[model samples]
Target: MGKITGFMEYERLQEASEEPQKRLKHYKEFTLHLNDADAKIQGARCMDCGIPFCNNGCPVNNIIPDWNDLVFHGDYQTALDTLHSTNNFPEFTGRICPAPCEAACTLGINEDPVGIKSIEHFIIDKGWENGWVKPQPAVVKTGKKVAVVGSGPAGMAAAQQLARVGHDVTVFEKNDRVGGLLRYGIPDFKMEKSHIDLRVKQMEAEGVTFRTGVFIGKDFPADIINWAKETISADQLNKDFDAVILTGGAEQPRDLPVPGRELKGVHYAMEFLPVQNKVNAGDKVKDQIMATGKHVIVIGGGDTGSDCVGTSNRHGAESVIQFELLPQPPEEENKPLVWPYWPTKLRTSSSHEEGCERDWAVATKRLEGKNGKVEKLIAARVEWKDGKMVEVPNSEFEMKADLVLLAMGFVSPVQSVLDAFGIEKDGRGNAKATTDGEGCYRTSVDKVFAAGDMRRGQSLVVWAIREGRQCAREVDAFLMGDSVLPR
Candidate 1:
């Protein structure tokens, strides 16, 4: 550790955020990064814990203590290097990841955790400002070709790793842009699209090809939502490339199959979120689903629902309300009982802080509307007993809702893509694959592999990156006799 007594001297200092009232006026990132001096102080807060559980807490297993010490000593370039060695996209995780690493911090047992995320944001931003993040093109070509489906974080990480190892990599995206969810699902207020664009440029410089608006399995019977200009068959991809990696995320959103679900105002969170992102990218969205002047009800208490709340507020909604089926968790977790592991606790996002009426243990019974449009939502208060929800008698209530957004999270990947390639599926319907031992990440079918949400079900960006990096190594080892890429 750079400072032995640093933890006792400094308290945790978070990055400053723009005033909610002012930030709602525009779709730009509001969180300010820590200055170098403040970042150093934060770095000094990292204790010389005999074992760094924070490393294991992170999905990508980042070397947190090393980077913290490096930053504390004012060696920012080395800190950036250490940070990037494990995680391919710290900027994305630093901004959006829930920071499980901090939850497992040794200091968090008694005091505040080290501001690891803020320090990471500072390091990555500094690296970009100093032009330290550049292309690391392979010196020699491997004379092999790889095809990566979906341009999400997983696909991006795999493509970069494979390209750096001298293989020809081409990333195919069904959307009009490179980033999959990062481009569409996330709001610009949380993370600007320019960050994705910069990484795309860097990957291109590293000899990875990006083909947008190209669907890999458009011929399937199921109608997949894509804006692809061309359709490529699974057989064609198999013949053209030595290896194919499926990274398309879980897109099958869990739907509320209740009365009036067919109402005009009811929609999936994906249907509403992508349109706003498109508008932010300067594209004119026709008949966009706007929450302006409407009583919006966002069902499901998760990140997506929180996003809906923030976007609705930005759209000038008359009111925004969110619902959760499960009971609210304790404000503070029992740290001793759940130390070194993610604990269940109440998490209020920035959107919730802005303005949102949140209710827990409330379930939507049905929707009542007229003229083929949703007007109100019927809900009930329920209690959990004997591992089941029992509705309370005389607890039925109705609320005005001009629009309803279902944000209950994804169920699985688009089935068509998996079926089109004749890939085997697990019990959960995700592409069946393992993460360890011989033939890791290899699908039942030959020469095809799966990673990210496509293989592991819906998950975090950091986990997706971890799966992608490991999948790339497996693919490399399968293609060649050996691989140098880390697991």
Candidate 2:
């Protein structure tokens, strides 16, 4: 409401990016941010609707309109504070989140939606630039100790919140560094590591202790449970510290079960993406998966597949083709029908624009190879009938594919971690934990609790953050017999 008729006077503006041709040459962030004046204009476009559907669209439930108005009025410090009140890491989401909030914007029904993501990005960058973002150590000590397993967004958020509430927080990460998938699975070009480093610094300053390179089950003996300030047997965690929260991410990747699946040139997207991220982080990966001078085929048509396309192009691949099992959607959604919701439309990613031959309604039937290495792919076209897919008899074809990447999504968290604690699992192999009533987020084992992908299955980073925050509130209440943290 800075400008009563701002929505009518101004149109939405999105951030620009470097051309795909020039950006494909290197692995670095290419999106140009909106300047302060431009960001204010975008913020002004917020109608401040009576009921903000964008809030419903956001998993984190960010106070979008409030912050938008604040930024429009040149009160950015307040805008930053409002933004952080809900989202733990705007920088992370600002860069990689799909921006479902924008899709659900009220303005989207008739006009372009406000550039909320860009304004968010601008608010945070300004916060950092102006030294407005800082760690706030708790004034009183609860002396309660909490153990958070895994160092992904959920674990990190839980640890930070618990520590800020005067609890002693220790984050155990099996990886060599913090940030979990954010550190490895995501390429630096999409998000530079410095953003994560800054948060780690803030968390450390806020009294959150991080123990990396220590796999709980592998590095620590079962008997070492007694050494903790409060020994919680995986069963005792059900009884011991004030409480234990498991926030490990989902890592069980879906695989292609087909002929020649075990060939050398075929690998999972996780296997390939992490090595490049490591190399970008200065770690030498011997015998890295290189797409240079090869015909690369990426299976699956989601973000991971798009990531594979980008990585392949960066490695100077001779040719790259992406495949999707579903039929191609229309280039433009029917706005009249799908307004304010994620629509079923053809979506082109920045990587796809770089250079990729995309095909839909196609299925890989088999892998044809020689000498224990993938050399080509055999595929077929299929059409959907009723609720099933039927293959077209005459559409079988073969294409050269020196390298194949299975970009199919993850299935669940590694079961070994859950099994080690003797926690019950849901039908999907995720830790069985409820989110309401007594003992919310509490496992069947007692004081032990779970959150994030480990508890809710594989999901977005924003959802993970939400789970972490909510789980921390539950843990805090269980410890103090009461709590003030929001759910």
Check candidate 1 and list the clashing pairs: none
The top-ranked prediction according to lDDT is: 1
lDDT of 1 by residue, 359-443 (tens): 9999999998989999999999999999999999999999999999999999999888898899999999999999988899999
**Candidate 1 overall lDDT versus native:** 0.93
Query: Which regions of candidate 2 are displaced past 4 Å?
Result: 218-240
- Give the root-mean-square deviation of each candidate in angstroms: 1.0, 3.8
Off by over 4 Å in 1: 219-224
Clashes per candidate (backbone, < 3 Å): 0, 5
TM-score of 1: 0.99
TM per candidate: 0.99, 0.95
